[model samples]
Target: MILCCGEALIDMIPAPVQTGGTGYVPHSGGAVFNTAVALGRLDVPTGFLTGLSKDLFGEQLRETLGNSRVDTRFCILSDRPTTLAFVRLTDGHATYTFYDENTAGRSLFPDQLPDLPDEIGALYFGGISLISEPCADFYAALAMRDADERLIVMDPNIRAGFIRDEDRYRARLDAMIRRTGILKVSDEDLEWILPGPGPLDEKAGAIAARGPKIVIVTRGREGAFASFSDGTMVTAPARRVEVVDTVGAGDTFNAGVLAALASDGLLTRAGLEEIDGPRMKSALEHGARVAAVTVSRAGANPPWSHELSGPDPD
Candidate 1:
């Protein structure tokens, strides 16, 4: 199983009302959560690990996971409230104003972390889970504990505004990065984490030195590229589709890449190290294909494995 570890929250997005202008509507979202949902829909045998509240919204989130077929066996339940993020989209890009004080997902601690089951083959980490408090450190400890065994995939999905202490967040992120075997990030994320004067590959190479054997940099509509420390590189262009909102595009893209890797029997530490140009291109194409369905939709809703197949003969 590919066990994703991170935040699960409610995204209140602006919606058109039946009789007037607009109102915010709740949706099950969070970068990591969306990826897990996408992976499950793609029949990836995925599971999610995070702190969950017993609140109404939390129950809704849990149900969404169940409906999507993502296992929630590792979720830590509490009476704490669920985190909420108000999303505003401008020209298809999303910005968030979060209300996350003392929430269940934000309050997790290292002591509450569950033991890694022997069945989990790949582990994923990223998003706000790498920025918050004791939970961030807990995730770091989790990563370090299994670094030598399972395949580790990470996407820092940095939101600079959410960070309260830059130094501490960067420190925690660096630790996780070193343990990551497959590191996926957006172009903007690469810029934020490696903010300096250098070529993109140079910056990527520095991060590769820290740990990862395979590094994927995604450039929205232009598609994504996968590079290795040995200098192997492959790029795939995004599929064209009418825009809706770009909320879960990247997360679904991550799911696609992971699913592709797993299907090709290339989801292990050795497989990542031995990845070549053709295998890397196949993964990138899968990510692009999956993400195309996401951007063409209304919200963060991802396509099921059946929906991802090409349309019946038109």
Candidate 2:
């Protein structure tokens, strides 16, 4: 089982206008939330750990998770309002403007964390959850204190505007990276975390030296690259598709990778490192293909297992 820990909130996306304009449409989203839902849709045994409000929006969010078959027994319900993010689409990409200060999700406490289940093979985390206060401390502690038996995957979905304190954000990110076993980040994320001149290979190598056994750097439509501790590196180009929106593509790609690993019994660190070149290539290709399906849709909708298993693009 793979457990995803982070914020689950409502995203107010722009509605397509038939009269040559744009309007807002609310959808359930949050980086980890999207990943968890995608994993659940793929028939992966997945759980989500986070705080939710008892408000109407929260109810809708919970219903969405349930529809996706994500286990939400660990979710905490609060009287506080649910977090909301306004999403704007431009050039096939979505930009989020969040409203999470003092919200229920950001108020998560360490004591609220559910016990790490023995069945859990991996723990996945990232996004604004690492930028908040008590919750940030809570997740950081989980990353540090958890035994190495379980694989810890982290994706630092960088949003510079949401991070008020640059120094604190960098420190927390570095700490999280050190604890992560499989670190998946985008090229934009690397630039935000480590801003400097030079090749990204050097940047990725520098990050790898900090600890993670594997690092994947996604380069949008150009494709993605992965570097392993064994000094093996591989790249997979993005699949061509008529992108409707790139909102949750990366998050769904993460789901695809985790789902593939879980299905193949590769959720453990040993299992991960044992993956051969062909298997690794397959995993990367599968991730890119899954992401392409997501990009071709609207909002955070990812492909189902049957959809992903269909024929590849010719």
> Each prediction's Cα lDDT score?
0.89, 0.85
> What is the overall TM-score of model 2 with all chains considered together?
0.95
Q: TM-score for all predictions?
A: 0.96, 0.95
The most accurate candidate by TM-score is: 1
Measured with C-alpha atoms, the lDDT of residue 78 in candidate 2 is 92
lDDT by residue (1-314, candidate 1, tens digit) is: 89999999999999999999989999999999999999999998899999999999999999999999999999999999999999999988899999988999989888776887877888899988889887888888888888898888999899998899999998888888888999998988999998978877777877888888878999887888887877777888988888988999999999998998888777766666667889889889988888888998778998899987776221
Off by over 4 Å in 1: 311-314
Q: After superposition, which runs of candidate 2 have C-alpha atoms over 4 Å from their true positions? A: 16-23
**lDDT tens readout by residue for model 2, 186-258:** 9989887779897777788778889887888899878888877666778888999999988899999988877
Q: Residue 117 of candidate 1: its Cα lDDT?
A: 82
Best by lDDT: 1
> CA shift at 251, candidate 1, in angstroms?
0.2
